[model samples]
Target: MKASLETLEQHFATVIAANELSHAYLFVGATNSGKMTLAQWIAQRLFCTNVKDGQPCGECAECRRIEEGNNPDYLVIQRATRTIGVDEIRGLKQELSKSGLEGRQRVFVIQDADKMTPAAANSLLKFLEEPASQVVIILTTTRLARILPTIQSRLQIVTLQSPTLATREQAIQQLGVDSTFSHVLSTTQFSLEDIQGWLEQVDAVQLQQTFWRWLTQILARKDSAFTLVQTQILSTFKEQKLQQLLPDLLLAALSDLFTVKFALNRPLNWTNQQENLQQFANQFSTQQVTALLEIVLGLRSMQEANVSFQNVLEYTTLRLLVVLA
Candidate 1:
């Protein structure tokens, strides 16, 4: 099941209702952040005939055809390739030259627009300058910084926030993780696909439990925090998974603690330790939390510099202890 984008869904529906929708849009977010889902929802909201309460009647002929990928007016350009080449953009441009088969409105969605080669991007850039009146071009990308400023300036940008903690927990459960496991896995900013990949390679739940214990020990200022790295963390988790997953989890945890310091009503990745985290948050000022975050980020960069994973983790723990002190 997909997590609901209730606010964005409603806003797009209202825009469609008023006929004030823009002809171009750029959806920006990390993977599994509902970029494609929101694009399809907008397509349905525009094409669905039996509208309900500013939402699409998903069962209608128009919506079903769109869902089944049989709609003549709706087009999507996405393929499994390292980079989108110039020829593909030509095909889209050729298609855009024609009138719609079924109606006045036509929707074109380009997934991973950031994958376009320079030539392909230039071709698409020309199209974005002037388009058919009722045609809408939606481009979704995980890397907005890579896109050219010329292309970016042409479209109305829509950003999808990271999924909620409850949404992520549900997704993890659906991956067959035990419901009894602490919801710590939800705190890491990984896509469900990436999470599934790691889960297949290692016992993520067990590693999370170990990490949680180590984390709590660190916050409690216990001496055992230093030894837990060798005894629990390094022993239980595979090196590859540790390199891939641990740093991001650490960053997410540090980010949540930063969020906690301000008493913000935001979701925490470490929901199970909310009480302890808040108590810890109270002890540190905002500058201290920022320092902690920078330390973790520096450790991440050290990994890129080919520092051994054990050294990175050991050093991270030491620096955290020093900073939190």
Candidate 2:
């Protein structure tokens, strides 16, 4: 559904028109890049009773049921926890072994396929090895490296591009947030679901402004910057509230600042805050900004590894101070 996936859509149309649909496919892309949406569209196309020009007619009963998640022939498997267990893969194999309930073909979509446990991934590899005649398997993931190589070898991998700023703005508006907040969120590589969850907990506009103010203080070598980190970032927000997301927001802002400072040709993610970014960019040397960006980026991996958020923030502040000095 994302505007950025036009090329991918055309490719699928061509494949269907040629009657060359693959048995197994891997959809790899950044989060919120429409991998799942494209997978669903492909499933609809395969299941639609009224297909026109290699695309689903959308008005067909089968297409409507698929859209409503009530299609008997279409199955979606997702991780209920941090990892997909081996049992889930076994269950999928069982489902695939049976005949299609309503249609001639069966489609299975596995979301976050990279989150499969090693055993689960091995099991999936075995399943993928034996192709069913009337079945299609589509796996979607933001982290392609985590998937097994044997499994990857069996799939026809399709890479997806990130959505444009304008497309993201429209999505944000539809989520019931002010469109201006997209200026802050669009800079970061977050999925639509991730953005919606964050917005539900806090005002994204205010959070963006607060991060900008904190970064400005750090750039100016103000003692209050550390104070803000301790009080606002660490003490006030708590780990559950802002730990993982704050680092990403900071990184996004710093990246924009670095681009502005170097007069890069790429578009700024925070277009609405151009004046503040320009001012901040003027205060830092290229080396200092680059160092800070690297530090912030590392924080993302650390956060994922279950590092202490407070320690990470304090260390980040110290590192920024050292870079600025």
Best-fitting candidate, scored by lDDT: 1
User: Which one wins on TM-score?
Assistant: 2
For candidate 1, give the lDDT of residue 305: 66
> Could you tell me every candidate's TM-score relative to the true structure?
0.59, 0.79
List pairs with backbone clashes in candidate 2. Answer: none
> 149-237, model 2: which lDDT tens digit per residue?
99999998888887676787788778876655666666555667766776777766567667767777887777688778777765435
Model 1 regions lying over 4 Å from their true place: 1-4, 177-190, 197-325
Root-mean-square deviation of each candidate, in angstroms?
A: 6.9, 3.9
Model 1 per-residue lDDT tens digits across residues 274-303: 677788888887888898899888876687
Candidate lDDT values, in order: 0.81, 0.79
